[model samples]
Target: MRSSPDPALSASSNAMLARARTTFDIEAAAVLGLKQRIGASFVQAVQKILEVRGRVVVMGMGKSGHVGRKIAATLASTGTPAMFVHPAEASHGDLGMIKPVDLVLAISNSGEVDELTVILPVVKRQGVPLIAITGRVDSTLAHHADIVLDSGVEKEACPLNLAPTASTTAQMAMGDALAVALLDARGFGTEDFARSHPGGALGRKLLTHVGDVMRSGDAVPRVVSGASFSELMREMSSKGLGATAVVDREGRAIGIFTDGDLRRQIETGADLRALTAADVMHVGPRTLRADALAAEAAELMEQHRITSVLVIDAAGVLIGALSINDLMRAKVI
Candidate 1:
């Protein structure tokens, strides 16, 4: 049996929900506030990044450092070469990583972080362009930067107004804006992004081709046009494709025979012993080019309500065969 609900516990849950809603409101407002300040400085930052010959060196301290690392990764994957370098480590020997050809994207809410501020002059001395994402536009970091993106928030989402909640969100949003702008400027397309992420789902979908996943050579089940009913059945069963392609003398697919056709013929009480591959096969079977994307093959199967398709060359000769199971195995589906 279910026990009665506790009144005190219910009240506590209500209070927690109210506080969570307040946090969401405050953080959302913080990100929206950034829109008003995006103008010349933001464009300048993008222009500088596009003009640079080397990778973007991102740096920050504390919570800002975490945001910076994510920003660096976003920029890198989106076609802008970038890497994160912790400000605290830069003072020791990591400063050497910032060459004259590189650009620095520094993130700090207060614009006065000790670890980050200490290395500004060294970065400037090396002639590396610096773009600052900070709350305080009049602070030292802004003064030293070649371009300053204002990511200031009105207040922290924390009740104590001390934790870097809303401030960090604003910084991350600003970083995303920069990465998107750079991606557009470089004309980075889906194929380019897929090349960088070859192991991901989008990469698999875009990079995988019919030629890569289709069964080639003897693995494809085939029978000549004049082949007997037994030959067609044996070819389909041995290859386990549930179907057999009836090819002409020059290896071009003329028709296809499947188990469905056999079932229908059996239901009609037709003579199966005297039939050849050409007599029972379905004419004008759907075929795809070998170089077409595997995704196209899956679409063809789904649209025509068929489980398999034959791959062909420029001359329409049977080159390979693909099945829905083949697409599933390659993770293209």
Candidate 2:
């Protein structure tokens, strides 16, 4: 039997849901507000990073430092070289990591964080280009920066308005905006991104080729055209490819025989024992070049509604075979 809900619990849940919705509203508005403030300073920051011969040195403190680290990673992965350095650590020997050729991107909500501000004069003395993302345009960090990006928010989503809620959201949005602008200006593409993230899904899809995933040599299931139906079945079962290729004397694929063809022949009541591979196989089978992308092989399989295809060379000689199962194992599909 079901029990009735407690009124006290119900009221508390309602209040919590309302607060959650309000937080989303506040954070969303903070991010949206950044769209209007993007102008000259933003463009200048992008241009400067593009012209730099060295990496972007990102620095911040507290919550802003967390956001800065993410920003640096995004920048690095997207083609712009970047790394994060903690502000407090910078005062104690870490500042040496910032070279004159490297540009500094400093993040602070109030722009007056002492750990961050204390390094401003030393950074300026070294003649390193500095870009500031902060709420206060009139603060000391902004005054010393070569470019200032306004990440100011109306208020925090925190009930006391003391925590870094909406403010941090605004800072991250600004960082993403800068990364995106710089990526476009540098003409960075998917292949470049994949190279930086080879362990990721897009990397596997773009960098993997048919040769990398196809079964080659003895592993491929194949039989001479004159071979008996029993020989074809044996090759198919041993290789576990669900199909077998019929090849000629020169080792070129002449036809293909699949489980489907066997079922069709049985349905027709044909004398299976009297058949040769050439007599039962389907001619004009689908084929792919070994150098072609695995993604292309997948598309070909999908287009023709087949579970496997033959891999051939420039001379159309059969060298390998690929199947849907192979693509699955490689995570190309």
Candidate 3:
């Protein structure tokens, strides 16, 4: 038998959970506070990036640097050209990555990081526009920046009020806001996003067509409407789609004979050898277009409680066959 747990430990666990909740509330409020600050400066930042011929050069230090890297990635993926360069590295050799056609986006909570300040003059001398995301508008970085985005938070989420918590969250929200605004301004569409992420699941969803993954030509099982039970069984066995399309002389699908249909026929005490394909076939079976998406195929299969479907053309001619197994093989499921 197990002994009872200590009440003091349970109380400590509850106290920790409460502290976490308080921290989340503080961060949520900080992000909400940014809504009032998306004004003229934010618009100006978007306009400046759009107007620039070169990429957005993002620079920061410490935790701010981590947030800036994500901002740059988001901007790049959303149709804007952008890259992240560490302030310390920029002061050394990475400064060459910045050009007059490019724009600089520097982030700092205090707006007075030494590594960033040292390189600000060089950036200004190069005639590049500067956008600053900082906590203090009066700080040196903000004073020299061409555009200032205020990322101040009321208080740190840390209990000691020393760690970067709410302020970093505010900065990240500002970055995301800028990325989304620029993305909308550029009119980036789903196809463009698919082009950028061709190796991911999104690419598979947007690029894969039913024709690309379906069984076609000899792989598709077909039988004439008056075909005998032995002939239908041979086609099903040869093609392995667990179903065969019953077509007319014009190659148009009129009905389907499936494993389910065979089972229903047997359950009804029908003589298998006496029946032709028309006797056991289901008329006007569900079919999908060959140009439709693989995701669409998956949805149709699940919605109609089917394991496979026939792919047809504009004239309702059966051209291909697809199954849930094909979708799983293509990783569309």
Candidate with the greatest lDDT versus the true structure: 2
Q: In model 3, which range of ten residues has the least summed lDDT?
A: 1-10
Q: Model 2, residue 240: displacement in angstroms? A: 1.5
Q: With candidate 3 superimposed using the best TM-score fit, by how many Å does residue 111's alpha carbon deviate from the native?
A: 1.4
Report clash pairs, candidate 3. none
**Model 1 TM-score on a 0 to 1 scale:** 0.96
Q: Rate the local accuracy (lDDT) of all candidates.
A: 0.93, 0.94, 0.92
Residue 264, model 1: lDDT of 88
In candidate 1, what are the lDDT values of residues 1-333, reduced to their tens digit? Answer: 323445667877867777877889999899999988799989989999999999999999999999999999999999999999998889999998888999999999999999999999989988999999999999899999999999999999999999999999999999999999999999999999999999999999899999999999999999999999989999999999889899999999989998899898899897888999999999999999988999899989999999999998988899889999999999998
**Candidate 3 CA-lDDT value:** 0.92
Q: Could you tell me every candidate's TM-score relative to the true structure?
A: 0.96, 0.94, 0.90
lDDT of each residue in 82-106, candidate 3, tens digit only: 9999999987899999999999999
| Count of residue pairs whose backbone atoms collide, per candidate | 0, 0, 0
Better of 2 and 3 by TM-score: 2
lDDT of 2: 0.94
Q: What is the total number of backbone clashes in candidate 2?
A: 0
